[model samples]
Target: MSHTLLSSPLQGFTDFKFRNAFNHFFGGIDTFYAPYIRLNGKMVIKNSYKRDIALENNTELEVIPQIITNDVDEFLFVSKYIRELGYKELNWNLGCPYPMVTKRGMGSGLIHDSKKIDSILHRVHNESDVLVSMKMRMGYENPEEILDTLPILDKYPLKNIAIHARIGKQLYKGGTDLGAFQKCLDNTKHKMYYNGDITSVAAFKELQERFPSIDHWMIGRGLIADPFLPSMIKNNTTEYPKNKIDIFSEFHDRIFKEYDAALSGPTPIRMKMLGFWEYFSQSFENPQKTYKKIKKAKSVKNYTIAVREILKEAKR
Candidate 1:
């Protein structure tokens, strides 16, 4: 079967600017899932969230909007909102493991309550015509939570289910439970996709060998850590471009320029770029030293210097 690769929704990093830039410079991802839109107490969807998933800005890539909400009303609201924006599909986020989200009985936290999952799906599927897919972890606290929830999901005509093989409590640490993922294949008839720890060509190949039938894959931090990873995986080549420095330099500059224009001051822009370096620094040969230099940069000039040094030391 032909394989399709997706860029997993990362709350801060995979915004429209990053999506457009990545597609322009390095094209491999079949679709980009937008970060989950959190509706405020006032029932307002933030303009920034609206702009991020707007079809006008995302003309170059196939994009799917994701929402993190346990409230059926909020789900219906977002569904109507996105459908109005010309989006045909919306992905429900049940994989976020952060405590703030979990404590609200949303994200992976909702996994422990199968009835809530059923209720939300029942209401949304009945009320909205928009196609809904799901992105989730095995469970929030226990590995078996998804087993109970999958049956509930099976009753709905979901577009697909993307499983991140670790339970929510694991966050991004530890190893993915391939054994459990194997069980997932048997439990449900819904089309399934694999997500998590796809950091290298070899890692992806290993998973492909283990689960050859699953042709859909979602990559998150790995894609940020190495912008060339998707292309490298598709081409089946471990070799990165010799001109990686120039290519990355252009990508970095575009993002910086966009953020600088939209954000208020140097500090906000500086903070934004620093967050990216947390994973992006891993792409370098001397990751610790590279990120340390970036962390110490108190000014934009110093930050630029650090970035230039990072490009000079890009892993060959």
Candidate 2:
């Protein structure tokens, strides 16, 4: 299979609308995996998770819906639901490291309990008619701890194993544990895809040189950081990614206009728009100045005014 690059889910950032708009403008990601559906015991999806990946007629990209649960029935419930919607693959989120998720004996927390992992995977695979995939970290508290569970995962017929290389306890704070990742490649019969810290062309190239066997690469924060990493990785064509600051202002205004209408209030809209600026600032000539302008805006009116003024200055 000729593999295509993909965008990993980043909770609030890369939802249905964001993916639709991104693929419309900049062609990079081959397929997107939606944020995990946090289901209750009744095998019913929470409303917010349901909304995050709900397919629209306008959503044109290839998407794999995902689920987060420790229960086999919930896993089966999600897989069946997505399959009926025409998605052939459903990814299981074993990588989320948040305390709340882990505390519930879900996400990476389940990695420690091999018997449960074995039981759940066996039951889900035996029951589900759709393809099952897994996204995971190296381990929960320590990288080597995952080694204990690899034998169990190898028994199941998984579509692919996407490893983030960092332990769950580390969250997104530390560097990838390349040693543990290498161990997975060495031991597991299942095919592998790499994810983590791929924020720039150079970093991606280094990963390519290091592991030429890998066919797919997934980006999370980096996609949001620049919104152009996929194009950069795919075609090496962002050789001249638009440097003019005015264009970013144009992009920001366009997204903000959309968010304001869809979201409930100014606080939510403002927070979302501001989050984009964290990565958007990297596109500026003076990153610090542009970031401050967005960060310091006092009101919704001021935010829009600052955006317009800075965009004008960008033309100078």
Tens digits of per-residue lDDT for model 1 on 1-316?
6789999999989999999999999888999999999985447999999899888899889999999998989999999999998899999999999999998998999988999899899999999999999999989888799999999999999999999999888899899999999888889999999998999999999999999999999999999999999999888899988888799899999999999999998899999999999998898887889889999999999999988877776634
Each prediction's TM-score versus the true structure: 0.98, 0.92
Best by TM-score: 1
Query: Model 2: how far is 287 from its true place, Å?
Result: 3.7
With a 3 Å backbone cut-off (N, CA, C), the pairs that clash in candidate 1 are: none
Q: Which sections of candidate 2 miss by over 4 Å?
A: 1-3, 242-250, 310-316
The local distance difference test score of each candidate is: 0.92, 0.81
Q: What tens digits encode model 2's per-residue C-alpha lDDT throughout 1-316?
A: 3446888987777777777777766668998888888776886777766666667632688888888889888888888887877778889888998999999988888778889989988888788778888898888988876788888999988889999989899988978878779998998899899999998889988888888789899988888777767886787654745563544455566678778888897778878878887777776567789889988986788888877776777667
On lDDT, the candidate that comes out on top is 1
Write down the RMSD of all candidates, one decimal each.
1.2, 2.2
